[model samples]
Structures are given as structure tokens and as C-alpha cells.
Target: MKIDTVKGGAYALTCTEACTVQAIRADAAFITILEADTAGQYSFVAPGEAVEVSDENAMVTQVLKPAALGVTGRSGIQSGGDVVLRNLMAEAAAFSGIVNANGGIHVPLAAGAETDTASVNRAYAMGMAQLVLMHQTRTYWLTSSCTATNGVTINHAAPGCYCEVLLGANGGTSLTLPTTGTVSGGDYSKILGYSIPFRHNGGAAGTWIKVSMLIGAGGEWTESLDAGMDGYRFRPVSGSAPSIARLVEVTLYYHEGYKSRVRELIGVGKPPGYVVRTTESSLNYDSNTNPCSAAYRLVITQSEISYTSELGAVVWLVMGGASGDTVVKLADIRGWDTYHTSVSPTLYLDVQAGEYGGRVHLESPTILNGIGNNTYVRYGLEPYQRSWITAEAEVPYKEPEQPSAS
Candidate 1:
């Protein structure tokens, strides 16, 4: 008798009469066997990856099919005594075919949440090993203490993965560099020195000397310095010689392809249409000195605006400009000498100008009376077209979704 199990659910089978079981079949390419016994009972989980099961006849067979995207199923089979079992399910040529077709290999951060030196090193090593096996390139961030003796080392010695070491702040201390030699079947070419400028909280400037080692093809280690880094001589005499300058941080980066993709996958890359905001001070502009005009006006000079918006247009809005009255004035006045008067407390300026770039300005004149000191002027970019309808509108911020480990 043949029994069918539901997909993505667990199952167990038991033989009632004295009969031999032929095989366990599944629609998925992989099945995980939990347990089996001679007492005519079998238990297993089916269909996310590939697994093998042995029957009383000692016949090895592929028991499941590759699962559909995001589908997980499990199943099992059993048999009784005095029965001749035959091959029930078709066999696959090789395991690699299934994995390749399904895109099953995904190397996430090793110890993604850990910060300690040992955990970081171990996670880096594991990630690098996985990358090496897949023949892909990636850059890993490994955090370590500035006082560590051995520092961090890459034992796998593959060219695809670059290891970047992030050293924490150390006060006037010297760090030991990795020595030159063969390690884990890989040769270390030599140690390269780098001189970088350092300063603490606007203090006097000092020089920080550091060293890094590289691994070439076939486990050969060599010294390589990235661009924009100044080379220096590394000489350590006797014990650890502490420097007068404090070390804020040290980063040893290895260059490799696919860095941007790796950064995007790890949620560190900047998303499209990114925007940043910086708040400027609030000030009160005195009434115009011209006695004949008697108009209380506020001027937002070009120097106050420092950031450029992605869109060339600049939208300005002023609130509570007139005393006691509450009126709103909105316009796309790009050039200077634009005047607006309102009896209400609100004033709005919509300037559609990228010609001035980050130097856009706003000037509002209160024709009714002198404006109050509580007035506010805000300048920002409206990504869409400039219109009076969206004067008070805003765009909401959304967080990026991370890839699922499943």
C-alpha cells in the first residue's frame, strides 16, 4: 500500500502486516531522515535539500525532489517482514545539480552579532571558507582589539575574499604585527608599513605607523598597500614602544571585486534616493531701516543654506510671520527681490531654482505691520513638481528589508 503525506508537514509510517517496504518517495529533492527501526517504523523530514535513506535491502536511493521556492515539506516510509523491496523513486545524477538549480548556497555573516576578537576571527574564517568553495569574491569586516598580540590572520589563503580589520581605540599603545612565514599551507610574503595622521578631539597632530600582510595564489603571503596610503618603515626595538599619540582607529582593507554587492547584501550600502537633513539655527530679523517703507522683513541669506537637494528645486515655507494674524503665502520665486505680504501669521516660499544650487535664499516682507520674533523659516527640497497643493505635504521614511536566511 502507498501512503501520501502533505507537503511542508512532518510524517511517520508503520507497517501493520508482514510485508516488505519498497521505498520512500517525495516530490522534493531532499529529505532528512530522523529515525528508523526494524520494528517496521520509519520517520523523516522531506524536501528542502537532499538526503539518503537505507532500507532492509541496503538500497541507497534519492527520496525527494527539489522544493519549490519558499516551500518546505517532510515525509517518511516503513515496511514489514517477508517482503521484497524494489527501487521506488527515480535517482538524480549528482548532488551538485540540485544545489546549482536551486541556488542553495548563501554565505551570511559568521557570528553576525558578535564583536569579540575570537568570534570575529572565527566568523571571518568561516565566511571566507564558504566564499572560497563557491568561487565568489567578498569583503568581510572583522573587529579586533588594538592590543592583540597576533592580530587577525586569514588561514584559507584565497584571493576572492578580502579581510578588513577594524581596530578599536587604544591610548598611546603599540600593536604587534603579523609575522612573515607560511601558515596553514599558505605563504605570507612580507609585512608592509603605513603611516597615517592621527589627532584626538582637535588635539595636536601625530603620525600612526601600521603594518599589514597579504596572501597570494596557492597560499603565498605578500605585502600590499592600498591606494592613498603612505608607506613607511616598520622597526620595533625591544619591548612594546608606546607612542605619545593616541590611536583612534586602524582599518586594514583588502581590495577585491563584488565589494558593492557584498555591502548591499549586508545592509551597509546606501539606498537609492537617499536624503539627509541638517538643522540650522533660528534667528529673528529686525525691521527694515527704511522709514518710508515701515515693513518688517526677514532675510535668509545664501550662506545659511549648506546642503544641496537631489532635485534642483528649493521649497521654502515661513510660519507665524505676522503678529496676531495667520496668513500663508506660497510661490516659486527663484531670484532675489521677490516680495510677499500677508495679514496672517504664516508665509510660504516655493523656489524652483537649481541654478544657485546650495545657495538659495528666502526673504519675506510683512506689509501689514512688524513681524513677531516667533516666526520660523524652513528650506527643503520637494522631490516632485512644485505646486501649492503639496505645500504642507511630506514623504515618509521606510527601512530596507533584509534577505531571509531560509
Candidate 2:
């Protein structure tokens, strides 16, 4: 007898007739008929008796992470006349051709002003411009001023005492006088007055120090100095140069060496469904009605398949992305919204899907006592699958006696 089997866990069998020549030719066909001691069933196994199942699906194997490259150094060279240092910083950040990729950078500068208000206002304006720039290019800059070099001394009972002034960096042309009475080495003293930059107290105690309107002029701007009482030698790093250099530093920071894929997918074929993890909130809207925007974000995570020995190929699939907007980013987003209304009044980006990885567009209106009232909406993505099956069971099987008891 011979049998054949197919690939699908099934087989075929064949048997020859008892009177066939092949049967007669068998070597010693049971030499003589032997009676069986017991009767037994003889069965033939068929290939169809067994079944096998296999699965073949695609999955992510590895992910190439993103990288970031930050600006290392920047400086504003040279100087211009009558310009606001703070404004220069803002302008530099705005005009710098640095790619930010939704990331931001900060630049520092020197502070100059006579009154606290002047300094504070300058800082505020610079900060505001940075914010605006972030909306457009997503970078920022900050300015810092040098600390006071010397303290002022007031002759305890005298109405006014001649104070020694030092020269600091674009000819800090003018300086203020101390409001507090001085006799000390480490106490804080306020710089008063305007129009004349002065170096509180520095240089050799008894050294001859005199101020003149001109480099060596002996008239008009002439003033004599007593010993520098700040316990430090005060002398211009150079003869007499102004320190008011109106310059703003510029820099940029952004992620690099990282690649991304965006894809817009639609349900297709028998059961079409797609999943997406957004990088950020897509919700945006008019600001007049509701001042606040929604606070959720989406980011995508991916894995790339690299094992080629058995599988032979690798593909990356986005598993998930960050969700929930951080409070800090949310505040910035709110400020951006306010800026839009005050300046342009139009919300910029809309929800859209990518093509390479995953994309989805969704709407979430602000809920207001079932009335829905917020200006912008934010949302997170949830994964979904199509072509899935679900099953349910009927009531449990029971004996008739159980029914009678019931």
C-alpha cells in the first residue's frame, strides 16, 4: 500500500485488491492461514485528520531617535548711536537665520539704564519681543548687565560729597549718585542723578583722579575725587571709554539628526482603520469668546525592524506619541493666542495628518455646561483597529431537572 500527503496537514491513502498479482507476489503471505486469537478493528489514518494554523503579521523592530544641535555662540559686533540695547537684542533674534524646528533659544545682553524703571521696562520689552519671535521662528534672547563695580561714600554730615567715578565699557557716559549715606565697604548704595556716568569708588586711595568733559579738559566737566572707599582699586580698564555698547546676542537651538514621517491614512479595503499619535495639539480657534485653549498633545513613537536573517526586511511603525500638553507649553500657547488676537487675530495651524507615518484630523469643542464655548480645543489620540472579530456566548448549558427546580 502507498499513501500521499498534501501540504496542508492532510494525506491520501490507497490499498490494492486482495486478488491482485501484487498481493500474490508477496514473499510469504502469511505462509499458511493463521486464525486470529482475538478480533480487532483495523483503521487507516487520513491526512485530513490533522489541522495546523499559522500567522504572518508585520511589527516594528527598531527606531532611530532624533537629535538636537544648539547654538554655541553669538555676539553683536560694533555699535550704533542712540539705539536701545534691548530693542537691538529683539531685532537680532528675529532676524537671525536659525532653524528652530518648533524648539526655542535664548540670548543674553548687557543692561544699561539710570532708573530701576528704565532697566525693568527695557527687560520687559525684550522679553515680549522674544515671545513674539518664538511664535514666528521659535527662538528667544535675554540680556544681562554687569553688577556695580564700586560703592558710593557720603561725608556723614555734608550736603554733598565729591564721588569718584570709574569708566566702564560704550562710555557709560553718565552715572547716578548714592542715595544712602556711606561709610562702609560692603553695603548696598543706590546710584542717583542722571546725565553723568560716574564710577562710585575705585583705584588707589590717594591717587590723583579728576573728571573733565574732554579727555584732558580742565573746564565744565571738572570734578575732583577723594579716596575710593569701596575697598577696591577703581581705574578704567583703559583710559576712559564708555561701556554702553548697544548690541544683542543671537543664537538658535533645534533638534537634528532625527527624521520624521507624516502620513494621512484613510480606512481602506474590507475594514479600513488607521491610528495616529500627534506631535502636538492641533486645536486652534478665535480668541474673543473664550480666552483659554485646550491642553492636550500627541507624539508618535516608532520602532524599526532590523532582524533580517529570518524575516529578511525591516520596517518602522509608530507605536505611540506623547499626549497631554505640559503646563509650560500651554501657557506659551495661550500667550501666542493673545498675541494673535492683538496683532493678527487669526489662529495659524489646523489639524492635519501626515503621509509617511500617520495623520488624523479631529475636532474637540470646548464644553460649557453642555453649551460648548472655548476658543481652542486640544485632544489626544487613541489607537484603533479594523478587521477584528468579537464573539458572545448564550446562556450556560443546563440539565432539564435544573429548569424544573427553577
Per-residue lDDT tens digits of candidate 2, residues 339-358? Answer: 11111010111111112211
- For candidate 2, the TM-score is 0.12
Q: Judge candidate 1 at residue 343 and give its lDDT.
A: 15
User: How accurate locally is residue 261 in candidate 1, as Cα lDDT from 0 to 100?
Assistant: 6
Candidate 1: segments with Cα more than 4 A from true spot: 1-99, 102-209, 214-406
Of candidate 1, the 10-residue stretch with the lowest lDDT total is 257-266
List the candidate 2 regions with Cα displacement exceeding 4 Å: 1-272, 276-406
Please tell me which predicted candidate would have the highest TM-score against the true structure: 1
TM-score of each: 0.14, 0.12
lDDT string for model 1 (1-406, tens) is 3334444443344433323332354553333344443435444343333334333333223335432233221223333233222322334344433333243444354455565755777777788556433321112112121122224232222222211122233222122222111122112211111111111111111212222211111111112122111221121222332221111111111122000000000001133221112111111222221110122222221212112222211223222322322111222211111121111111111111112211111121211111121111222122221222222222321232322211
